[model samples]
Structures are given as C-alpha cells and as structure tokens.
Target chain A: MNLEGLRVMGIDPGLTRCGLSVVQAGRGRAVLPVAVGVVRTPSGDDLALRLLRLSRAVGEWMDEYRPDVVAVERVFERGNVSTVMHTAHAVGVLILAAAERGVPVHMYTPSEVKKAVSGNGRADKKQMTAMITRILGLSEPPKPADAADALALAVCHCWRAPMLFRQRAGLIDGRVSAAKRRTPSPDNHDRSFPS
Target chain B: MNLEGLRVMGIDPGLTRCGLSVVQAGRGRAVLPVAVGVVRTPSGDDLALRLLRLSRAVGEWMDEYRPDVVAVERVFERGNVSTVMHTAHAVGVLILAAAERGVPVHMYTPSEVKKAVSGNGRADKKQMTAMITRILGLSEPPKPADAADALALAVCHCWRAPMLFRQRAGLIDGRVSAAKRRTPSPDNHDRSFPS
Candidate 1:
C-alpha cells in the first residue's frame, strides 16, 4: 500500500497509563481502530523493566496490527526534572519500539495535534475529544479516550507528510545499510540512525 | 519475605529462547516451577521494542507468580561480543523487570552456576540437568529443561555467598545508580528504566 493508505499506530506514553491507538490510513480519513488499551506495570518493578515492558507491550500491538507508521507524542514540558527523566525514559521505550521494527515514525507535539484537530494550538482534552468524535463520526469517544488522542496524533502525522516521514527514517529497505553499518554499537553513546 | 523463604525467578537470557524458571528458597532445597515457557516477539518490530517485549513477557510472569527474587546468568565469555552485547541487553530487560518490582537479584556466571550444580566447575548442560533433577527429587526432568537449568542457577546463587562477586562488581546497584546519574543519556539509546 502507498504511504497515504498505510496503517498507523499512535501512542501517548504516560506513567500510570500508556495510551495507545491504531488506525487505518485511507485518504478519505476512513480510520478504523485496530487496537486500543493500556499496559500496566506495578509499582514494584524497577523503572527500567517497566519501560522495557512498556515497549514490549507496544511491540505486541505492532505484531498484531502491523502498522506501517508510528506517531508518538513529542516531549511535553515535564513539571519536574525527575518527571522529565521518567517521561524521557518512557519515550526511550517508545522510540525503541519503532526503531527496531525499521518502521518510520512521525513525532507530533501535543500542540501540533491539537491545532490539527481543534484548530487551536492549546486545545483542551474535552475539545480534542469533541473534535475527534466529530471528525471520526463516532457516537462515544474512543475507549480510554486518552489513547484515542494518541491515535489521532498518528493520523495527523500521516496526514501531514506520509512519504516525508518514511524517507527521513530511512525505511526504504537497505537504502542506508552502508550508513547503518557505520553506526557505532557497544558501550559507545553516539548513534547514527539515518534521519 | 526473607531471602531463604522467598520464591525466586531465574532467567536464562537469549535472543530466541529466554529460559524462564522459578524456584522457592528453604532450609535444604525447595525450588519448584511456578510457570515456565517462551513469549515470542514477532518479527518486524524494532530491536529495542523486542527487548521491551521481553521485559513485558517476563514482567507478566513476575506479576502472575510474584517471585521475590530474580537470578540472572552473568556474562563471562569474550568470543561472541555481538551476541554477548545483545545478551546483556536482553538480560537488562529481565533485570529491569525484577528491579521494577524491587526484587533483589543475584547474578552468577554460567561456570559458577555449573560448578554449584555439579561438583565439577566445567560441567556441560547434561551434567547440570542431572544435578538439577537430583536436587529437586523429580522423577521426570522439567519440560523445556533450560527452564530447569535456570532454576538451578538461581538456587545455587541464593544458597551461595558472593564475597568474590562483590569484590569484582563492588556493590552493583549503588555503583550503577551513581553512574547513571553522572553520565549523560546516550544519544540513540532509549534508557528503558528510570532511576
């Protein structure tokens, strides 16, 4: 299928709830929900394993849905440094999920998604929900509707520039194998994914 | 729970078959299987996400079973660097699972576990399995016996002291936390765990 019609998985990573939504990517905005839910990690597990589990949970979604694109929430203004660190760790879990699949990911800020859906950069959850319901032609809002917001983000991203996301992430199959070969591995921190 | 009375989750980390076993701690030896099996990460997902999925799979195991401790296979070989790296990564996922639950971990080298299980330090898989059967008083061997071996390693680590292992790693938890705080996040790495 072409970029405009590919499957998209939208995600909103959070501490208590990691929101997730999968939607069909047809041109007529015929979005269908493939899956939606949250993965819960108890307070007892370490942060690392929790993040790992979060990523894995999403991977299971990928396996079942086989989405061609992943659109995730960009870093919002975390209230505390500690919270930011936690959110960043969660973001890591997310990026790893898509990066490993060799699937192209398009990141959208909460503001951008808000603007796209509600025509305001600072749309409230209610507004976003209302707009999402209106746009998707649904009676009730999506389940765990926060997850639906993530799906909306993914749909928005694909709508923004489907082909551009793929090209930047280098998902063209060995298009940058040589470049990836030079990407450092092991205890080193520097990474060289094709952008 | 006291270390001696707690149930332990033993992990044998690998790319494809991550051996999972559970053992109970007691005066003499009372390790038993709580749950044992493989949770496959379907292909086409990202590598990091696979690790995340591994963590989640093992996390589910821990949640369902509530093991008090986790025992992991330590890295000692040098020839297979890439495999070792991935093994370390995979182990990280499992370890993170244990950590999220605040479950203490006891890591042992393959040889050390082998030595503890068999009288010989360099015992092979068959020898290790035999010892495991004898110790557990089982007529038939555990199914998918890698799980059995993992339990044996956990049993050994729990029973044995680690004066030497401590001398080498020097308070693994404290050092790791300090190092993470000091170092900048790796560019491409998604730190799956939070401090």
Candidate 2:
C-alpha cells in the first residue's frame, strides 16, 4: 500500500479539551505536520451544548482539512468512570462526524500510539511530546499535552496504516496465517520505530 | 408553568438496541402515548457505522415527532464496563442530536424513572412494565423490555417536569431555601402515587 501523501487526522477526544491534528505521510519514515490545535468546551456548560460545540468544531476541521482517514485514541475503562464517560462521549461525536463525512475512522489504543511514535509503549508525556516535536520537525513542542498527543496519534496511524491495510487484505482474501489469526496482544515494548 | 399538551421523547440509549418513545402530557396525571419503538444496529458492524446508524434513526424521530423535550436514561458506571461505554456513546449521540435540533434534553437515572412511574425506587422490570401499561392506558404492555423502559422514562419525565421546573426556577431566582438547596436524595421507596 502506498502511504505517501496520505493525509491523516488524529483526535484526542475529551470534553474539556480535545486535541486535533492533521499530518501527511512523506517519502519514508517522514511525516509532515499540516495543522494542530485544540478544541475546548467550558466545564460549566450543559453536556448537550458542550457536545454540540465540540461537534461543530470538529466538523469544521474535517471540512477544512479534508483528511483521507481519521485516527482517534480509543477510550479505555481504566480511569475515573465519569471522566471515561465524558471522553467516550467526545469520541462518539468524533466518530459520527467522520462517518458522516464518509471518511474511514481508525482507533488506536494509547499504548499503541506511544509505541508507534516513541518506540516505547510506556513513554511518558514529556517523552511523547519530545518525539512528536522531533518527528514533525516543529520549532517547539505542541502546546498542552493534548496537542502533542494528537500529533503522536496521527504519526502513529501514518506509520501503521500500511500494516493495517495488509492485515485487512489478508482477512478479506481468507489467507490469514496462524500468526495472523491470533488476536494481536500488547507487549511491554515495541521497537518497530527507532527512538 | 403549564405542562398540558407538552410532548416528551424518552430514549433508552444502547448500541445494539435503543428504545425510543414519545408521550404527550394531558391535563393532570393523564398521559397519551404518541409513538413507541426501538432502533436496532447490527452488533457486527463497525462502531462508527453503528453510532452513525443510531444517530440517523434518533434524528429522524426528533424531526418527525418534534418533541418539546427529550428525556434520556442517564449512563451509570455500575454495569459491565464495555456495555457502559457503548451505552454512553449512544447517549452522547442522542444528546447531540437533540441539541442540534434545539430540543432540550434531560437525563434521569434508572432509579428515578422507576420511582416516578411505580412509586418505588427499587421496582423490578415486571412491576415497571405493568405500571407503565396502566399509566399509559395501553391495551397490552409494550413489547421488549427496552420499549417498556422507554415509555417509563417518558412518563417519569412527564410526572417530574413540574418539580424540575420549580427547582430550576428556584436556582435562577437565587432564593432557594435550605431544603430546596440540598441535593435531593433518593429513598428506598416513594408513594407519591398509588400503585
């Protein structure tokens, strides 16, 4: 699969502050940053109104950037239940927006994202920000952890898209081997990319 | 505030099966059933597609019924984590759809709905179905537990609307008394209405 010039949008979903970024895959092991920012909703606002605001912001980004694929961080049930619920809400809206626009959506777990970007599944926030800055050749680390995280997600998707495409192709062709048939399990560390 | 003729839509949000119902408030405790059904999405579909399908179904209902308010069953953290996450995602879409069309949305807990309908906060499903059928004057109990739950939610909101209105009024007027200011607590059973 040719990933060159493939545009990807990544979203770090949250009610209070959602990170948004667009990145394009370059020749090889190179990613070009297109856009990066955050969308925020006031905590005091009604949940419906907040969701509406976030939806509109994301819709506008989709319209403007028009990425080929959207990658979002999958919500996990490990944190505070209320916080997880809110994040899941944002994720739902994001996915709906992408699907409405007829764009394919992909979700990557946090560890998967960190492994793809920083070569360490347990990379800390500072490490992720540093790696993202280096990968995107940005002058400074993206402001707020959310913004950096979004960029990392996009980069991760860009790197993994080819492999994902191959995996899907194998499944569609009914040629999945024994190794591929096994549900992929997470490892303590991933070295697919150099740190 | 007069609630006569006020139409309310209740939603029991879930990914696989979402129950939807609309009811109109008549004079006093009289309630008229306007519409009732369930929207279903295949479990095998992708999460994005499932959410999109549910959102469109709910949007059509909102557009066709044009209810004055939407009452949704609030998502809690007590259930299976995965189920709760899926339910919350559906809830987010429902709330967004209502907000998009400028319809006000209110959420009630399962216990609150049970209490409002059966006068018992701990009423079982059979009791709730029986009470809902009696309250709505339906010849037969609504089929599918989800459908019955939806009707119960709408009826609960109808009965509690006046009190919620007064509570909001007190808050806006900044004259809430100590009793009014305290967060309302739920008791084991309520006998506001004869069962």
Candidate 3:
C-alpha cells in the first residue's frame, strides 16, 4: 500500500484569507481541519508581520503533524497586480517555511484542484464545497473559499497524485518534469545543484 | 548519474534587482554564468507590466535553461517595512512562474548561504563575493549585488549539499528517522503560529 498512514498538510495560501487543513491518508483519506483562519492586516498594520505570523503558523503545523506531503494551491490567475504580488509574498513565506525544513513542496493549479474536488474541472466554489464535504464526509461546508481550496489540494494529492503516499514526496518538478510525467519519471528529482 | 546533466536555474528574487543564473548540473558539473541583469521597475512604471516583464524574462529563462530545479533565495530579514512587503510580492511572482511549469523550487536563507560560501555565518557582501568567486573558480566578480547572491545560492547548494554526499548538514531535529521518518523541516523559514 503506497499510503498506509499518510498525513497531508493542505494550504490555501492567501494574503488576507489563508486556510490550512490537515488530512490523514489511509485506504480512505479524511481531512481533519487542524487549523483554519485568516491573517487580516488592517490599515497601518505591518504586512511583513502578518506574513511572519502566517509562516510561523504553518511551521507549527509542520512540527505538530509531521506531514509527509504539503500541497499548496498555485497562485496562477489572480487578476489584480498588487494583490497578486501580495499573494506571491505570502507564498514566498509559505514556501520558505517548507523549504527550510528541507521538505519538498508541490503546487497544484486551481483548475486541477477544482477538478479533483468537483469532478468537473470548471466547477464553481459552491460545487467545490459540496463535493469536498461529500468526499471527506464532513458535517458542514469547509467555510471560506480558501478553506475549500485547502481541502481541494489535499483531495487532489490523495486522489490525483497518489505517490505522495511516499514519505518524501519529492517535488513533482513543478514544471516540465512534473507536467510531462504527470507521474514520477526517472528524472523527477535531480538534487545535483540544490538550494 | 541520477542528475542526468540537469540544468539548475538560480534566482536572486527582489523587487528592484531580480538576477537569473543558469548552471548545468552534469557529471562535470559545469557552472556557466549565462545571463545576469536587473529589472528596474523605473519608479513609476506599471508594477504589473514590470512583473509581467519579470515573469516573461523568467519564462524565457525557463525556456532557455530547462532547469531541473529552480533554486531561490529565501527571504531572511527585511528591515524596511514597505520594502520588505514589496520584495515578498516580487518573489511571489517568481514562484508562480516556476509553479506554472511545475518547476521544483528550493530556497536557502542569507545566513545559510553565507555560511556555506564563506565559512562564516555573518559574512558580508565583499566576503561573500570573494568566496563565491573562489568556489566557482571565477576570475571576475559577478556583476550586480543580487546576481552574485543568486549564483552564490546555486554554488552553495552544489558545494555544500552535494547529492551524493551522505552527511546531514544542519543541527536540529535529527532524532526523526529518514528511514521511516519523513521530517519536512525547513531552516530560517521562521514564522509564528497561534500556538
């Protein structure tokens, strides 16, 4: 069995609304919402401090759960430039938290995750929440959109990318190697010149 | 032999100075300084376009290098409030580009790179350049402050975290078993949680 007992830390990283969900992978995986909330940097509040708080929260999750895999939603299609930029900074802090631990990080596109959660690739957020609740057998909706997105990433990894079942879950290339193979290829992980 | 002569793309991500470096990781491990330049947003230029340009340039690098790993410099300390916030956004864009292609990203802190390159935990720029030049066996100093930082990260990984080198580097949480324990612990990726 590839995933005998794998716990996945799924993150919907956002500047204002960041949702963190932890799920245990078994024959049938169940997403237990370990932590979920927002980091609202009100006017005059320091953005850097907000980011610092987010990173630390994620790190704490790392220490507590000791997850085998971390699935973060790729920030690809945000329309606003500065907001997109802020989202990017949040991601930097998030990725930094993961990378510092020497843990490999994998990013899933919004569409890919939506498809995993909703069956239809273009399903709306309403559908996503409905599907997520059904798949995980949840009592209520995952709450905010980011929370749904967080669960989507976990479900995506559980259903779409199963090898995350492995302990390391070394990055799926995050580009060509990951895109091309869509599964593990021979050259999936080349650590010759690491970061 | 596992590396398959992969090319590693090194990026020193910044708001004013984002430097891109390409190093081919093969049997001989050739570290070639292909391109080094900065994208100045020109004070009032469209931040989006500037980012789009940065995105395009990064895309071009991805096309040119076809890097197996996108090594990024993890943000360590940002003294300026607004400056640090903007820098975070800039890095967010960079991660998006790599994430789009599924480009595996790795990050190292300023201190980690400094210690790796110069044998001193608190080495400054001049000391860093001297060590970087020596390690890459370069005759001339790499231009632009951030470019040197970028190249240094790539070389830092090459010299310090060699793939075949079987030695744990950092000194924390070694108790977890890699044999059955997968610890996705990151360094300098400090953040505070609700705990």
Candidate 4:
C-alpha cells in the first residue's frame, strides 16, 4: 500500500452504538467512502456480551476491509461517568482487535477530529455534518450522528497521515522548517456553511 | 477431565494489577491451590499497550494452566469511575481470550464470593482471608489482598459448582423435597475457624 494512498478505518467507539467507517485516501484528492455502518448492542445485555459483540464485529470488518490503518476516537472524561466507562470498554475492544490483526492504530482527540474536518477545533455538530457531507460527496450527512463522527475521524486521519508518517519515520526535519513555526497553514482555513 | 474433579482459574481484574489464582476441587475434599500470581502493567503506558500486556499474560496463563473453567470477578460500580472503566476493560480482554480459546467462563459477584468463602455475605477482608487460609489448609492467607480475593473466587466457584451442576443436569427432584432441604452434611461441618 502506498503511504500516500491509504485505506483507513475510523471508529467512534461506544457500547450501545459503535460507528465504523472505511475510506480510501489519496494525495491531493477527495476521499472515497468504502463503507459506513454502526454496530449496535442492546443496553440490557451483559457488559461482557456487549464487548464480545463489538470484538466480533470489529474483527469481521478488519478481515474484510484490510485497512492499512485503524483510527479510534479517544475516550475522554466529558460525558456521564457510566457513558465514559462504556466507551472506554468499546475502545479497548477495538484496539485489541486491530492490534491482534497487526493493523496499526491511532487515536484522534475529538477536537482534532473536528479541526481536521471543519477547519475549526470547536466546530458545532451542524458545521461538522455539513462539512463531512460535502467532503464525502454524500447526498446528506451520514445517517446518525455517530457515523458522521466516524467518517470525520477517517478524513482527519488521512489528512494528517503524512505528517504522522513523517514523524514516525524520523523524517520530520524536512517537514518542520523554522519559518513554519508558530504560523497556521493556509490549508486550515474554515469556510462557513453557505447560508 | 473428570466432571467431579475440576480445575478453575479465577481472576480479579484490574488494568495495572490483575490477580490470578488456580485451584482444583474434587468431590468431598478440600480445594487445592494450584497457582497464584499477578500480572502487572505500568500505568504510564498507553491504554492499548496496557491491555495488550494483559492479553498476552492471560493467554500465557490459559496455555500453561489449561484450567477446565476460567472465572473472572464481575466488574462492579465503586469508588472511582476511571477505576471501574479500567477494570471493565481488563475483564473484557479476559473474557475474549477465554471465548476464543473455547474455555468456559463464569462471573461471580463480589458478595457471592465472600458469602461462599465465609458464611456472611458481607465478610470483611480479614474474615475472608482467615476463612480461605483455613479452607485451603494454608498456614496463612494469600498475600496482597488481590490474590486472596482471586483465591476466594476460585474456591467459591468450586464449592458452588456441584449445586450448579446438579441444577443443570436435572438431578434434584422438581419439588426439592423437605427431606433434601434442611440437613447439613457432616462433611460440610468445617468449624475450625468457627461460624
């Protein structure tokens, strides 16, 4: 797989509803969505059963998609404690699935996901939906908010992959020059929804 | 493997410190301690890396011990949300490992463990330790509290397994006659430590 043209699977992890999306990204070109879906486990089920359901779903996706990289939303302590705990469990299962399959995994903070997709770190849900729909050339934002978040993460990972790849390869010197310090790139320009 | 003589692996799950104990129990005899240890992962490591460390450790135990059944303490809500989250993640990895290996898995609540080990459902740590040491014919209780909890769980499962097996096999009469209900067997009168 060319580092420039990578297949990425992004996950918005949760126990009740886990969002998963796969995208093919190429240099200087729009991304192509390969698949977008959510895995649902009933809330009343045992936690162990719920995790097992997620593990199987994730394992199946990995085997079928053969993604070069898998990205998951980092679990933060913003929501209800129970919700955060469940999300952490889901993320753990996803990470284990990817790790066992030998697929590289990355975690994107929620703010970073928003910034990558909408060009604003604090982009609201409406702005995020609009930008992702336009970016993916979808008729509308992906069904359900979680799917949109997952697609946004995939797009974000693709956009940032080169910098990450460079850093990982110990080639960051060429990418980070003295002049680029403390200056925001023009590529980060945010556009308003055409209202 | 004889059904009457079963080996069990009990886990007290935690991300940083997972306690493991193996015990063998046979009909009308004292439960024997097979092994006891803890899997430690550094808190400074990435969550995924920590989980991977646990997964490998659990896999190693499962292979080396080959217990007839693997039991894990059910994750319960308590002190800190973060602590519960980490424990849930640890338990999920363990359950997945056992499920993948075709090993039977059981979950015992903390109260049930204490009740089975000691007569009281809410036995304190000191009481539980004394009971387990006496029950297992050990000179002293297992160290580090976590190991004791694990051994308690394993012994509890063994003590309860016969009743569970009978219930599952439809051995007991449908009515559970008065003659079968009230008499405590002579073998169960282990009063060395007192009730």
C-alpha lDDT score of every prediction, in listed order: 0.65, 0.89, 0.65, 0.80
**Model 3 interface RMSD over true interface Cα atoms:** 12.4
Q: Mind giving the per-residue lDDT tens digits that candidate 3 earns over B119-151?
A: 676989998887667656678988888888888
- Candidate 2 residue-wise lDDT, A1-195, digit = tens: 578999999999999999999999988668999999999999999999999999999999999999999999988787787788888888899999999999999999999998888888999999899888988899998998898989999999988887777667767756454466675743323335533
The residue-level lDDT of candidate 2 at A3 comes to 86
* Pairs of residues at least 3 apart in sequence or in different chains that clash in candidate 2: none
What DockQ class does candidate 4 belong to? acceptable
Tens-place lDDT digits, model 1, residues A1-195 = 255457788888765577887877555445555666776766676555676678678888888888887888776443664454455456655655676677776677888777665667787888787766665667788767667778678656655563355445665667584566577633121111111
**Highest DockQ model number:** 2
10 residues in a row with least lDDT, candidate 2 chain A:
A186-195
Q: Give the TM-score of candidate 2.
A: 0.92
Model 4 lDDT, residue A123, Cα: 92
What's the ranking of the predictions by TM-score, best on top?
2, 4, 3, 1
Per prediction, the TM-score for chain B is 0.73, 0.90, 0.76, 0.85
Question: What DockQ would candidate 2 receive versus the native complex?
Answer: 0.74
Model 3 segments more than 4 A misplaced: A28-39, A163-195, B1-195
Candidate 2, residue A104: the lDDT equals 95
What are the chain A TM-scores for all the models, listed individually?
0.75, 0.90, 0.76, 0.87
Off by over 4 Å in 2: A172-176, A179-195, B172-176, B179-191
For all candidates, state DockQ relative to the true structure: 0.08, 0.74, 0.10, 0.31
What are the per-model numbers of colliding residue pairs? 15, 0, 15, 0
